[model samples]
Target: MSEFRKCARTAEAAMRSVFPATPLQLNAHLSARFDADIWLKREDLTPVRSYKLRGAFNAMRKLRVSAPDQTIFVCASAGNHAQGVAYMCKHFDVQGVIFMPVTTPQQKIFKTQVFGGDNVEIRLVGDYFDDTLAAAQTYCSEAGAAFLSPFDDEDVIEGQASVAVEISNQLGSAPDHIILPVGGGGLSAGVRSFFGHSTHYTLVEPEGGMSLAAALETGAPVSLAHVDGFVDGAAVARIGDKTFARLSDMNLSDVLAASEDRICATMLEMLNVEGIVLEPAGALAVDALVDVADQIRGKTVVCVTSGGNFDFERLPEVKERAQRYSGVKKYFILRMPQRPGALRDFLETLGPEDDIARFEYLKKSARNFGSVLIGIETSSPQNFEALFRRIEQAGMTYTDITNDETLGQFVL
Candidate 1:
């Protein structure tokens, strides 16, 4: 075996003492839909509900062996990483200081606290993650604690490689392709290194956080100017330097960007159809299947479902985004005459499958006409075409603001 694979095997062997191997099961739903042998490496089912625990446990185990006196560990994260570190700290009986942004949801903070118990100190630091990270590093330097990076450390990378080790053993052979979700590139780098061209690979990222693609183009990691934080799990602004070094040579075409709205649709499908709850980042690999359907057809493919840390509170937003993306829901501003029958005229134009979701008057005081905001939900996308025709035939003027980001933000 190659040196990297050997180290990965060692890590995998060590992981059994901490937690059982995550399941690798053939997904009949995905197999039938894609016309391929679709296997899911269920990293989402880990103790901390993410592949992150693997790296955290491995890194801390090796660290304690090498430097017995270094009992204090520090890390900064808003979600899965924090929970992973907390769980490992408790398991190892080590003291850890975890820094998280103040804006982190109470649900996440509560879970982290429950995982770490008394072994981890939770610090609610700055408003932003970057600021929280800075605070953690500063505290580490002042207190002489060892700072643990979420993805930049060599030991952590080695730990993540354990995922690949498990996959190979579980599958009994290399698959035709492996699809991985890239955040800071740790998981992708580790898995890619272990396989080393033995199989084809597809790297996926949230469209708003395509750090790997940007790094490949610039020849170095560069911070994105703006990032949509909807996919908070994989919405990294920049790829980690160490992780990027291993993945830098990958073909740019292999990197796929999934849209935030479209990802919501995938999340809903997995929940409604497959009965799986996936966080935004956790769903990346599966969501990417749409883009690679042709390439993976009739081949054995594995998709690593990285995490399942979804908050039930976000379900409404997820549903809304899914409906919007599928064109089953839309918002529009209509110009209506300032008369009693004018409102009834518009109401009479609705098709049988159309339902009004939202209605508000924007210009109630107009002398001749009033502007009304209307949200319509229909059974199918074609329903909108028919609805629009009815509105036009009635001589009512309207602007479809469902896709107008600016207007949607302000009104919808």
Candidate 2:
């Protein structure tokens, strides 16, 4: 075996001491739908419900041997990495301090605590993740603690390569195509390095957090000026410097940027149809398949359903986004007459399946017309065009605010 393969195997062996290998199972629903044999490297089923544990375990194992007296480890993360480090701390009976942004959800904080038990200390600081990361690094330097990076370190990348090692062994061959969701590029770098020259690869990144794309364009890692944090798991502002070095030569054509709302549709479809619970980033690879259908058809494809640390509270938001992306829902600013029966006349245009999700009169804009914010959802996307057509014929002026960012942010 190559040096990297040996390193990955060693990491895999260490992981077995903590938890069993995650399953590699064929997904018939996806296979039949895409006309491809789809296998999911179900890293979501791991003890930490993410592949992050593999990196954490491997990094700690290597560090423990070299610096046994270094019992304190430190890390910064808003979600999965924090939990992974905390879990590893508890498993190894070591102390760790995890710094997280204040914006991190309570559910994530609770999970990190549960995983760490008494071995980890949670520090809430900073509003943005970058600020928290800086704080953690400073704390590590001052406290003499070994900082455990989530993905940027060489050991962490090598450890994450274990996923590819397992897939190669289980599948008996490199897959035709392996779809990877790019965050800091650690997992993608690990998987690509393991496959060597065998497998065709595609990288999927969230549109708002296309760090990989930015890195590829700039020929080096660059922080994004703006990022949409909707897909919290993989929405990184910058690709890891070390990991991106390995991925810099990859073809730009092989990378895809999935819209946040479109990703939501994939998440809900998998949940309601396949009974699979996937965090937003987890669904990126699967959703990207839609864009690359021609390339993967009739071939054996593996998409890493990377994590499932989805908090249930976000389900409503997910559903709303999915509905809008699928064209079955919309919000509108209707200019209604101030006279009575105007609301009734507008309501008459509704199809049987159309439901008023939001209805509120903002204020009277003029003596003759009042501005009303209306949100309508229907069983089919086609209903909106018909509804709008009727509105036009009836001389009812309206503007669809569904795709209007500034307006939607303020009102919806």
Candidate 3:
């Protein structure tokens, strides 16, 4: 067996002691929708609700075998990686210090603690992941502890490769194509290495944080100047250095950048229609299929649903993005005449399905007119066309600010 395959086997063996293998179930909803055999390698169903635990367990197991005397492990993360390390610390009965950004969700922090139990210590270090990572590394060096990277280590990559191994074995054949979400690139690198030209591959990443694409462009890993952190699970500012080394040869054509709003639509669909709650990163593979329609149709495809550690508190934001992506919701600044009953006249023009989501009057900018911030939602995208036409016919002046990031951030 190749060294990579050997490591994957070890990872698979280690996982069996903790939990049964995550199911590789064929999804009927997506299958019928795409006219292709759609299978989900449900990493979301793993013990930590992500594939992260595989890497954590494999890396820790190898460390214990090689260094026998080392008992301390440290890592930094805001979500899945923290939970993964915490769980592994409990299993291996080793001391672990996990540092996370203070801005991480309480739900994630709580779960990491729960997984580690008495074996792990949680530290709130910084407001950003990069800062948290630096602190953890420093602490590890000072304490002479082994610092575990979330995705940069060879052992971690080998551990992640086990997912593809299971997919291949469970399906009884190689898939025609595999759609994977790339964050730090561990899962994608490991999976791609295992497949090794046997199966075609597509890498999906968030548009606001295109780490894999950036790595491909630079011929090496590079940190993004700015990244949108909405897809928290996959919104990495840079691909891991080790992972990029393996993925450096990938062509730009194979990578797809999914808009944050477009991704939210997939998240909501899986939740409401498929009864699946996927974190934004978990939805990346599925969302990218829309961008590669011709390549995936009529073929057996597996889209790795990477994680399901979605906090319910973000539901409102998810819903808003989904609505905006579908064009059934819009926020606009309306120049309203200050005449009495003018609001009534505008209301009269809305379609039966149209509902007012928000209405706020801004400071008077002109003598006879007021800047009214209005948010309207309807049952379908077509409703917006009719609504906009009605507003124009009524002689109401308005500017659609639905897609305006700067304006929406401040006003909406």
Candidate 4:
């Protein structure tokens, strides 16, 4: 066995003292849909509701063992990583200072504090994560504290490799394909290192945050100009330097960029259909299965459900995104005649299945015309086509704003 595999095995054993291995269960629903043997490596079921705890525990344990005098540890994260570090800080009885973006959800901040109890101190630093990370590093240096990188450090990668070890042991052998969600690349790189060529690997990242894909294409890590925060858990601007070193040789074709809207749709499906709650990043692997349906068919495939740290407050946004992606909903602006019974005439243009979700009268653009911002929900995308055609035939004009990002943000 390779050095990484050996160290990963040791980390797996050490993890039992903190938490038992997460489940690797066959997903019948996904299997039937994809015509494959779909197994879910349920990292979401961990104590911190993420695989992040494994890395945090391994890194913190090694630090404490190597430097017994070191009692303070620091890290910066907006979500799962913060909770994991806080949990381990409590376990190691060490003080942990966690810095998170000021815009981080209050639910995540509260959970981190609860997990660490008195051992953790949360500092809401900057609005942006880069600013927050810089502030955390500065504080760690000034305080003579150990700094923990969520994915870049060697120890954290070794710890994350434990997930692969557990999956192989539970499955009785290496799976034909292991699909992993990539953020800074800790979990995917670690897992890949442990298995090597013994198992085929597929890496998934958020469509708006294709850091891993960027690294593979450029032969080195490069910062993306823009990153969509929709898949907050896995949306990283750049892949970690250390993690990318391990992934540098990967096939670029195997790197799948999962759409953020599609991820939200997957999240809803897994929740409603399978009773499995997956965050957007957690759903990446499963969502990528659509792109690999043919290759994975009749093969044993594992999709790592990486995190379940979903905030229920985002449910409305999740539902909206899902609807938009599934084409069951739409938004548009209607030009109504500024005369009585014109509203009734416009109402008649809607199909029987179409329901008005939102309607607001904006300013009158002309003496005879007024702008009406409208949202319509229906049973199918085809319904919108029929509804729009009827409106056109009725001598009225409208603009489809469902895909207009700038306009939707302002009016919807």
Candidate 5:
């Protein structure tokens, strides 16, 4: 075995002391759909419901071994990494201080507390992640505590390599393809380092936060001016410098970007079809399979479902996005004439399968015509085509705002 793989094996052995290896299960639903051998590295089933705890535990364990007196660790995270660190702190019987954005959901905060128990102190620090990270680093420096980076640290990278180690051992050999979700790129970097060119890799990122693509284009990591935080677990503004070094030579073609709404559709499909709940980031790798279906046909492929920290409260929004992406739901602005029976005429245009989800007048007192906001849910996408044809044939004026981002944000 190569030196990197050897180290990864060591890391995997170390992880057994903390938690058992996450299962690598053959997924019949996905395999049959794509006509390929599909396996899922179920990192979502980890004790903290993510693969992050491996990295945290390894980093802290290494620190303790190298410096027996080092007992304080600090970290900043709003999601999976925070819980991972908290869980490790409790297991190692060390003091850890975790800083999170004040805007973090109460559910996440409570989970972190429950995991850390009395071993870690939770600090609600800043409104944004960057601010929270800065505060954590400053506190760590002042208090002489070690600050554990979520993805930028070498120890953390080595820890994450354990995932690859487990995969290789479980499968008996490397698969034909591996799909990985990229954020700060720690997990991808570690996995790629361990496997090298033994298997094909497809790295996926959220369309709104393509930091890895930006880094490759710039020949270096660069901060994005804006990032859509919808995929909060993987919506990093910039790839870590350490991670970029490992992925610098990766082909840009192998990197895919998944749209937020499309990812939502994938998440909902896993839940409704397979009884699997995945966070947006967790579903990214699976969602990217659509872009490379031809390349993976009849090949053995593995997708790492990174995390399952989905908030059940967001199920409604997830369903809404899935419906919009699937074309079963839409919102439109209609110009309705202020004459008698105008409303009746509009209602008559709807097909039997069409249902009015929302109908409200933007302006009710116009002398000639009133602006109305309407939402429609239909049984089939073809139903919308027929409905639109009827509206056009009747000389009714309407604007489809379902895909109009600015207008949808304001009214829909």
Candidate 6:
């Protein structure tokens, strides 16, 4: 076996002493839907509700041995990695100084603090993640402390390979295919290192943040001009340098981009149908299953449900995105005649299955005409066709703003 593979096997063994292997169970619902043997590598069940702890544990353990007198560790993360590192710091009885953006949710900050107890100190450094990272790096340099790169370090990648090791052991061999959600490429690169080309891997990235795809396209890691933060867990602007080197040989056929809206729909489906609550990034692999549904039929496949750290407060937003993606809801601006019976006539145009979700009046364009912003939800997408027809027949000029991202952001 290669040195990396041997080290990964050793890391897997060490992990068993710290925490049990996350379950790899066949998912009946997904299996039935996709006509495949769909297994879930339930990383969501980890102590940090993510596979992040495995890497953190492995890296920290190796460090503890290599430098017996080293007691300080530092990391910068807005979510899962912070919790993972902090938890391991507590386990190793080392001082940890974690840096996070000032805008990080209080819930996350509290969770990290709780996991580390008194072993970790959290510093809210800057408003943006970039600034926070810079602050953390400077602190590490000035204090002469060990800095943990969430996904880019050699030791970290070896640690993350433990996931693949566990999967292989649990299944008795590598499965026919494995699907993983990609962020900075740590997990994908690590899993690839252990499994090699024996098992096919489908790497899914958030459509708004396809850093891996960008790297593969350019033959190197490049910073994205824009990144959507909706899928915060996977919204990396650039693929990690070390990670890219490991993943540069990936097949184009194995790469995919999952939309934020589709991910929300998958999250809702898993929660309502399977009682699985997945954060947006966690649902990426499952959502991409649609793109490969026909190809994987009758094959044994594994989808790494990356994390269950979903904030319930975003439920409404998730529902809205899902509704829009499913075409069951819409937003439009109607030019209503400014008269006594105009409102009544407009209401009469709505279909039976349609219900007004939002209504607001804009400035009157003319003394006889006013603009009305309307949000409508329906039981079926087909209902919109009939509803739009009625509005047109009523001699009303309307603009569909549901898919108009700029107006939707500002007005809706």
Which regions of candidate 4 are displaced past 4 Å? 362-366
Compose the digit string of candidate 6's lDDT tens values, residues 1-412. 8899899999999888778999999999999999999999999999999999988998899988998888999999999999999999999899999999999999999999999999999999999999999999999889999999999998999999999999989999999999999999999999998999799889999999999999999999999999999999899999999999999999776889999998999999999999998999999989999999988999999999999999999999999999999999899999988988888998999888999999999555558889899999999999999999998999898999999999987987
Count of steric clashes across candidates, in order: 0, 0, 0, 0, 0, 0
lDDT of 3: 0.91
Residues 11-111, candidate 2, lDDT per residue (tens digit)?
Answer: 88778889998899999899999999999989889888999988898899999999999999999999899999999999999999999999888999999
- For residue 63, give model 3's deviation from the true position in Å: 0.3
Model 4 global lDDT (CA atoms, 0 to 1): 0.93
Q: Which residue pairs in candidate 2 collide?
A: none
Q: Write out the backbone clash pairs for model 5.
A: none
Q: Global lDDT for candidate 6? A: 0.93
C-alpha lDDT values of all predictions: 0.93, 0.92, 0.91, 0.93, 0.93, 0.93
User: Please, what is the TM-score per model?
Assistant: 0.99, 0.98, 0.97, 0.98, 0.98, 0.98
Single out the weakest 10-residue window by summed lDDT for candidate 4: 362-371
Report the C-alpha lDDT of model 1 over 1-412, residue by residue, as the tens digit: 8887888899899889989999999999999999999999988899989999888987898889898999999999999999999999999999999999999999999999999999999999999998999999999989999888899888899999999989889999889999999999889999999999899999999999999999999999999999999998899999999999999999999999999999999999999998988999999999999999999999999999999999999999899999999999999999988887998999999999999999998555648988899999999999999999999999899999988998877886
RMSD of 6: 1.1
User: Which regions of candidate 6 fall more than 4 Å away from where they truly are?
Assistant: 362-366
Q: How many collisions between residues are there in candidate 6?
A: 0
